[model samples]
Target chain A: MATQSFKTYFGRNSRQGLWYVPLLITVVGAVILTVYTDDFASPQNLSNLLSQAMPLIIVAIGQMIVIVIGGMDLSVGAIISLTTALLALDAPAFVLVPAVFAITALIGLVNGYSIVKLNVHPIIATLSVQFIVVGFARILRPVAGGSVPDIVVSCVAGTVFGIPLTVFWAVIVLLLGWKLIHGSRYGLHLFAIGGGVSSGQEDAAHNFGISDQRNVILAYVCSALFAALAGFYIAGRISSGDPGVGETFALDSVTAVAIGGTQLSGGIGSLHGTLFGAILMVLLSNGMNLANLSAFLQGAIKGAILLLVVSLQSRKKMGL
Target chain B: MGAIAANPVLQRAIRVPPAYLVFAVLLITLWVTKPQLMNVNVMGIFIRQVAPLGILVLGQLLVMRVRSIDLSGAGVLLVVNYMISSGIMGDVPAIAYIAMALSVGLAVGLVNGYLVGRRRVSAVIATLAVTVILTGIIQFLASGKPPGDMPGYFNDIYNTKIWIVPTPVAFWLLLTVLMSLFLSRFVFGRFIAAIGENPTASHFSGVPVERTVIASHILASVIASVAALVQSASVAVGSIRLGLEMPIDAVAATILGGVIFGRGDGGVWGPFFGVMCFALLFVVMTSFGVPDPGKQIARGLIILLAAIFYGLSSSEK
Candidate 1:
């Protein structure tokens, strides 16, 4: 049923395949806004849009990996909360900054071990971690008032060649994602582990000596590191460490990746699409804000879009 | 610990549901430290506090038994909560509110069922998205304005007691009993068990897998509305934030009751005690003068422990 629809929709030499669906939607959405609203393509609006996507882009990088690995990390947002809290704590940047990555990586290891070694379901394990970390984040700073060092601010906030400093960071992370997943032989193994595994064949990747467990652990570790970077940048942008910041990154990243055309059930995804997907999501929100839409209404729109993306994407792959 | 758990006698006892053990330990601690809490009347007041959650679990377990999950209870609770507290239906009778809440729940549940059962969307993602949509709708409708007070008529119904038990607690108990009977005596129970054990097998065996799953979701949402009604009444003054955590708590309580995801090994009594354990836990924590943050931490720890225990049990199997 799905194949018939796909062939009809994309035509015979569909090089880009279904990835073009999200790209088309994003372009159409942007085109409508540009024509209807004068300031939609203004310099200020464009810059603001790119900057808004900075932190989310980083978080989505991590989420893309986990989604590819057939697992999820609900604690991603919590890790951001924890990172900012630690960054805001009473300590020098030299001492506290490294602590953020180390601790997040350690937490990621724990998350990975629980899922891989202890055999806990990814959702259950990560959700429990979410509760633990969220409570701790709140407890650490009930009110958001922690100072971010000036040096850290300049590093993440200062611009390069008149563009946002964070955009540079975004580009770097994007390249890294591309290289890791689409370049190296190791990357092919990562995809092999998630993709082409017969259903319920838990160790099918093992037959290829792909080391599924190691790759799963690596996926989580990368997620934590990327989330830490996002938290660091957010703190720098705000000039304060906020426990409340990045609270939506966990689920929103899932939404963004899905919109970018990544399958939630693992395997068959590309970060290239995720990058545009994140931009599209932020653009929609930003566009609505400029339109003077109510925040409440925006929430509804976002949720509805998330549902649509998850369900509609499967129309040809797993047909509803 | 493994050796002890591996013992045949211990295995049978462990299968009795760990909620009892936790309840016993907590109750004993309370007995020694705050014997005043042992009074039946006092216990009734505390039990009333968690009756809503107790009711929600009945639905959660049913959905889980059919190898699906209902995370949309919070969404139903919020919408019903907004309706009653927002006074959108001003000057209406209590039955009107009740009907509206149940209907709202039924609508949401049917959507969830159709999405998961027919469309084959993942249960977690569908239900979660439903919650987000409902939350957004409530937020949009409220428009940053706090909700007004709940009508007094519902509160009166909430307060009414037959004998010493509060009306809400009694309602919860009655529902639990009815659910047990429904699952045990009816053909639906067979469908649930068959589907839960093996969905494909159940389908091949002519168990009407899709219908059973959808029916369970419908039941879950309707019951969640009942829970929401009780919750809104207890507060009297409406708050938008009441039910956000209830679904997660319901899942935790269900797990602690020994009903792992897609399995109903503990039965209703275990979850009954699971809800009791939560009530007692709050009582004990409050008595000990633990602050709200501390209680939140303890709650997280309990959930993590449950997850860890589940891992242990599954790995052992």
Candidate 2:
């Protein structure tokens, strides 16, 4: 029955249906906002939404890659929190940023090592990493007192000719990420790893195949790298590194990735989809604020929309 | 097969659960550094405080074994804590209060089960979404106020001791025993193990895989609600943020207890000891004047160790 329904939908171009639903939801959301608030489509709000979403988009893109390779990086939020705290302690931008990036990469290596050598599931493994990093974050800057250097903040926060600095960073991260995944041999290897690493190389003659173990580690490193970068952006935005600020991003990033149609079970998805999902999420949150919904209600609304999107994605993949 | 038995040295090293050993080492270090810290009377209150988290871990471990998770416990804890203190069930008998709380837990669990089991939703996402909704609903209801003074009677009961042990501790031990018996002696126990090991195979073998998974989740939620009541009763006043860390902490403690995804070795006893380990950790930290942030770091490190232990164990298997 599921196959029959899937075939019927495909016969009518079901792939097109995916785009329509999210688009329709966005349109309806826009309409509702326009009806309710005079500043619904104002230029400032539009820019603010994208700017607010930029960090999450970077993180989501990273998360999307890891998830596609059949793993998760639960420590991204903690990494961001830790990096933000680190950035606050008056270290030079040149030294601090690179140091944080390296530390994050080390964490990713630890995560990858545990997943590959120790054989722990991604959920438990990443969750533990999150705990450790969050704890370290508190230890580093228990409160929101440390101010990121003005120079660094200005760089991240400044506009580039008409484009927001954050937007520019997003574009750079997206292009680099896309090229790595679509342009390089590493990309093909990742697909092979996700497709069943053992079989893909064992059966094929054209194997530029690195071990699945290596891919897993690299994926986690990438996740941490992006998360740390996002942390820098967040520190810029807040002007002060807050220990607890990155707390919500754990759930939000997951929701964004899932909404972008990345299967939680892994082996499928595109960074492009994640980019759209992040935009939609930011817009939705902005729309909710305009609607005068409470912060708590806004969260619930995000989760519900996430549920609908993920379910739709899963169902389509299940050929239902 | 050769790796399993040929390495006698490796086998010896792997015999005992690492967390338990770590707990012992930490305990001894603390005892030596501050001889007065190990006294039962001094440590008892702190142990009692973490009992709520320990109980929540038991439920968390069970769900995790079935290859599922429940972030909704925090939300369930928040709402149930509110219900008990809100005067919503005004002047209800103590037993009735307990019953009402349990029912609320079961209801939330039912919804969670339907989404995860029947609907085939991602367990983490589904439970997380439920948590989001529940958190919102509770916040909307409370208008962001501490719900009410936890009825005085609950505080009295929670604090009471049997012989030397606190009531909550005793209650946890009893529940663990009953849970162990239920899992080991009953058909349901076998079903749970079978389902966790391989859901598809269990289904093929005539087990009601979905039903077992759902039932475990519901049972786990019910246990969490009970923990919330005990937790709320321990506190003098209610707060909106009560039990916010229960889910993650429980996950940590449970993992420490030797229950990793779809496999449990330490069983009830393992998690029971894990809770005791947490209790002792707090005692040690406070005695040494490690400060709050230091304590958080310690807790996180312990959790990380548990994750490492899980990875090591599964790979060996």
lDDT per residue as tens, model 1, A1-320: 89876763364433122556678888899899899988878877777778898788888889888877767888899888878877888888899888889989988897888888777767777777777777787788777887877778898876788887766887788899888777787667766666643144567787877888888888888888889988888888787767778777888888888888777766657777788888888988978887899887787788788877777644211111
Which ranges in model 2 have alpha carbons more than 4 Å from their true place? A1-20, A31-39, A197-210, A311-320, B1-15, B242-244
iRMS (Å) per candidate:
3.7, 4.2
Candidate 1: chain B TM-score equals 0.95
Error of 1 at A77 (Å): 1.6
Clashes of each: 0, 2
- TM per prediction: 0.94, 0.90
Local accuracy of candidate 2 as per-residue lDDT tens digits, A260-290: 6566656555666677778778878886776
Which residue window of length 10 is worst by lDDT in model 2 chain A?
A197-206
lDDT tens string, model 2, B1-317? Answer: 44763487866666455658767887888778888767887777878888888788878877877878888899888888888888888788889888888998899899888777777777777787778878877887788777878888899888789999999888877888888898899998888788777776887999987888889889989998988888888886877773446787787777777776677777777777777777777777777788776766666677777777666655565
Residue-level lDDT for A212 in candidate 2: 70
